[model samples]
Target: MLTIAPAQAPSAADLWAVLTALRLLDDAAEDAAAARIEAARLTDETRWQAAGPRRLRQALTEYTVHLARLADELWFQRDQIARNALG
Candidate 1:
């Protein structure tokens, strides 16, 4: 038989760090979304003719969507953490 140790509670500093990181992630997600829009506009305007502007735009759009989903997940986690901490 084996015994497992109980999980330790997170410290205030740890929670603060996680919250800060979440904020940064949210900011990055917003930036990525803006970049995706700009990429699409540039590709459509024919000014970003860099051999594969369409491909670049597609990749940026995908990246932006992924970042947005990740931000949503992190926000949910942050909310859960807050609820737990408060209760």
Candidate 2:
């Protein structure tokens, strides 16, 4: 998902929303990882049903990283805007 920060100053509300979404995504990734581990424990050597959950966990991990980058960029941009305002 592509998140475009607003052209205007970043509001506290916007940051809060992003943080909440990130938390939920983190929780889901953790659950998926747990499921993968359980599947590994329960399944036989020949069984490979955990692949889907494993892939999901990886994807979620990547998504979290992407969101974190976005958040960082948002803060940097907000800081730049503030500096420009101060000058």
Candidate 3:
């Protein structure tokens, strides 16, 4: 929640503008990446104990890799878009 300063009261347009400027879209990718990594580590550790050492951890390993790759691709595209817009 953003509080409007007494000196700079926000208008209806300002509030609407904030709605359009959703920051979560940009953060989603990074959040997914971190979540994936943490999930994978925990899953792998759990599996290692479950039945001795295993080569694969279905729940976490695959998702972790996928998420990391997705984050890289998303950020890369975002940066490229910014550069293109500026140039």
How far does residue 86 in candidate 1 sit from its true spot (Å)?
14
Model 3 lowest lDDT segment of ten: 16-25
**Each candidate: what lDDT?**
0.65, 0.56, 0.65
Which residue pairs of candidate 2 clash? none
Report the alpha-carbon TM-score of model 2 versus the true structure. Answer: 0.44
| Cα-lDDT of candidate 1 | 0.65
Per-model TM-score, in order, reads 0.49, 0.44, 0.55
- Per-residue C-alpha lDDT of model 1 across residues 1-87, encoded as one tens digit per residue: 999998788899987876776677567656755665665565456545576876776676666566556656656765675566544
Question: Candidate 3, which segments miss by more than 4 Å at Cα?
Answer: 1-25, 48-56
Scored against the true structure, residue 51 in model 1 reaches a CA lDDT of: 61
lDDT of 3 by residue, 1-87 (tens): 997876655678865554434344358777877888797777757646454344446646777888888888767765665454333
How well does candidate 3 match the true structure in TM-score terms? 0.55
The window of 10 residues in a row where model 2 has the poorest summed lDDT is: 39-48
The whole-model C-alpha lDDT of candidate 3 against the native structure comes to: 0.65
Whole-model lDDT, model 2 = 0.56
| Candidate 1 weakest lDDT stretch, 10 residues | 39-48
Task: Write down the RMSD of candidate 1 (Cα, Å).
Answer: 6.1
